[model samples]
Target: MPERFPGCITRVRGISAGHFTDTRRPTGCSVVIARPGAVGGVDVRGAAPGTRETDLLAPANTVSVVHAVLLSGGSAWGLDAAGGVMRWLHGQGLGLDAGSPETPARVPIVPAAVLFDLHVGADPARQPPVCPDAAAGYAACQASLERGALAEGNVGAGAGATVGKMFGMGCAMKGGIGAASVTLDGVTVGALVAVNALGDVRDAQGRLLAGARTADGAALRDTARALLAGEPPAALLAGRNTTIGVIATDAALDKAGACRLATAGHDGLARAINPVHTCADGDTLFALATGQAPAPGPGLNVLAALAAEAVARACVNAVRAAASVQAGALWLPACAQELPVAP
Candidate 1:
């Protein structure tokens, strides 16, 4: 792990409490807000995405200090899980009018994102249309703030996530959430990603890490190549696929800047994943500022590139942390190497 940035850097600590799998085997992951009054913004790239409270990230939105963030399974229906987060935040009096002694106290906002995972072949009862355990994961996020240590891999939102949908669910590989950070000229930029792309996972050097084979381990052409050859890209569906992520920095930025940064961060996803942001892919990125430090002096372009690199690193890490499932297993290339740092 890297050292925390200077000047009141935002400290992140989260965990996966309990997990809920839908009839489609999508897993729910949740995290709590360890710090109060954290500033944030969001960018949505996927045309067919399912989300909750994203409007709060807009510049016109007045609320701040989100109590928690939820990433889960259950497709669009998973949006219901946020109700539990509201319930928890309400109890702590952590919302808008948090300190007031009124019957209707304000609380921290809770924003959530979801991925598709209905084809993993888990028990039907386990793979219901909705998941309440996702809310339990939010409670766990709060508990993890008091408790030390964060758990990763096939837990939380990544619990039931899959990648390389070229052949549909039958050939997708297990993928989950991943995080990474980098320091540029003394400023820190970190990224968190839920790696549920419709394309194959690759290393920084563009080597295929997984998703180019049949379940039986037979080698297949690259998803992009297959698509260009007029083969049916089974994974490229308009409403069924998406990859989501968040970028956090200490720099002071308004919502518009945050949105621009989020757009730039998508370059990282393009670099790390093949055939990204296709008509069938719903890719989104969120940029957040804790407002605890000044922006780097090198200029916004430098910061943008740094943010993009952090996004790429986060995408790679997410793929690396994904656990193998029965339908399709994730495989990192033995010969894969990291990209060389720019001179």
Candidate 2:
């Protein structure tokens, strides 16, 4: 994989990404594993969010090592996957060293979050919930244990993802997972994101890439504009949209720096996803450092900048990699087929 893309995320030592999906229902989960345990941090922006172990990633948190980070579907229920991950790590004897005769010497720390993908596929009443659980989480981890090229788009937590629902599902489009990596000198940064937002998706150049469309599917439409007009084609929802992801690097960094890096990582989401972090979304990002490279003398400023770029690139890649699908009253247009949205 490195021979083709020297900047591949898997090139980082002791890092692997895996995804598990139930395509029948359009819901799944993605796992990012740092077997050596990387310093981790998180930043949450959306008003309605679902998460697990985010507090541990805070600067004030006592724990310093995070064994894995899980991004999944099925709203709060998806958090169940974390337990499976913890058990897997514990079985492997990987985690914080507690060093006690009574209790296990090591306990793995696995933080997780989920996006709402229930609105897609068939009606909510008729379908069984597809949120990833202990079994699914364990399966994804076992698959991820192997280091290799990671797959993106229409997988993991993004399987049932859709965007531009400000005007409701009728105007929404399909969203998926995207990934990108960068290497410079001795620093390497990579990002993976599941693109699911309540607004349109865009490119760094500010061009409309994929989004809501007119009734006839003649052209794409601006979701914000429709909302600003003081009317919506469909009723707005409370918490069915979000964009979740992780940014990782080999540089040495503390929990605080990781927190700051995660904070800065939002710029990438803001850059690529129009009208982000709305009340209905659960936008979140996690940053981790493997400490393979020397710690920056400053606040890891250069790597932070690169982290933002990596995220932006990943966002674009997600949109580009997504395949169009029909969900309820909406029809998503793949990036490859995206024509100019109506002005």
Candidate 3:
């Protein structure tokens, strides 16, 4: 039997995850495959987001389900990776039926989101910036089928991710991908987040986990505190930062309920990251329901609460699992590397 990934999204029935990491550059894509199809809903809270096929996820849309979701690096350019996922699903003969004559075959429904990690391996003077593409997406799908456990941290979409950029890359710390799940009765809700935010990350108890550092680069400089103190950001890049992820559940839910779950996920983001959902951050979350378990007695309310907890834990895990990175002149440290050891 394949090894199980404890607390990962794959713990939910009908869900599987795979990733493709670029060797030449710190960039890649992550694929969440639900080949059997599942109800999908999305909520984009970030002012500037890079996404594809999100409109169909709205409650009013006609599409009933989604086969997969893509989270990738390379900003808007990464959206192309979804095409590769479509090709893989098509090869497997898995997709929604297209009733039209021009396209009679099954068409896979893939919704995607991208975060900015274009600077990790960028050498503009020597070569063009490398980004995730269709091939990367296809490779990710293949890996998903072969791997039983999902790898977290500096891999896949979050390969080049970073956090606490208020003071710029000089003080920013490495961020990556993390997954977690919450089970109540028979229902399971899981979250997978790629942390690349423009703000500081904190735990549920409000303790600073990672964020910008002082000029001396010794300790964390709370972004919210600095902002409230009327200190201006030393470096601000608009539309260059985002935190993207997906929430999955085994409970039954319609499009509207899924959307509500997606919204509830943002509460998790807020709980873990300070100064989120800003003009510069594109925080987007997608929710999927496999409908394998009965709906909770308290309806989506209970499920939403569980989702929030999972998301928060996933976000925290992302930073904690990340390892320090040295890409060119940028030497971003991971939270684990910077945090002081308990005495």
Could you estimate the TM-score for every candidate?
0.80, 0.91, 0.94
**Best-to-worst ranking by lDDT:** 3, 2, 1
Best by TM-score: 3
* Highest lDDT against the true fold, candidate: 3
lDDT of 1 by residue, 1-343 (tens): 2221221112322211223333334466555352454566677777777777889888787764445566666567666777776676667666667454556557667777777655554454643544535355455455544543344446666666666777666555666766776765556766767777788777676666655445444453467766777877553457466787667776666777766778889988988888787676667786766555544544567768978888887677766665666543433221122212211
Q: With candidate 3 superimposed using the best TM-score fit, by how many Å does residue 30's alpha carbon deviate from the native?
A: 0.4
RMSD of 2: 3.1
Task: Give the poorly placed runs of model 3, Cα more than 4 Å off.
Answer: 1-6, 100-103, 126-128, 294-298, 340-343
lDDT score, residue 161, model 3? 93
Indicate whether candidate 1 or candidate 3 has the larger TM-score. 3
The 0-to-1 C-alpha lDDT of every candidate, in the order given, reads 0.61, 0.79, 0.88
In candidate 2, what residue range of length 10 has the lowest lDDT sum?
A: 1-10
Task: List candidate 1 segments past 4 Å from native.
Answer: 1-26, 32-34, 64-67, 98-104, 125-127, 130-134, 146-149, 214-216, 235-237, 294-298, 327-343
lDDT of 2 at 5: 21
lDDT of 3: 0.88
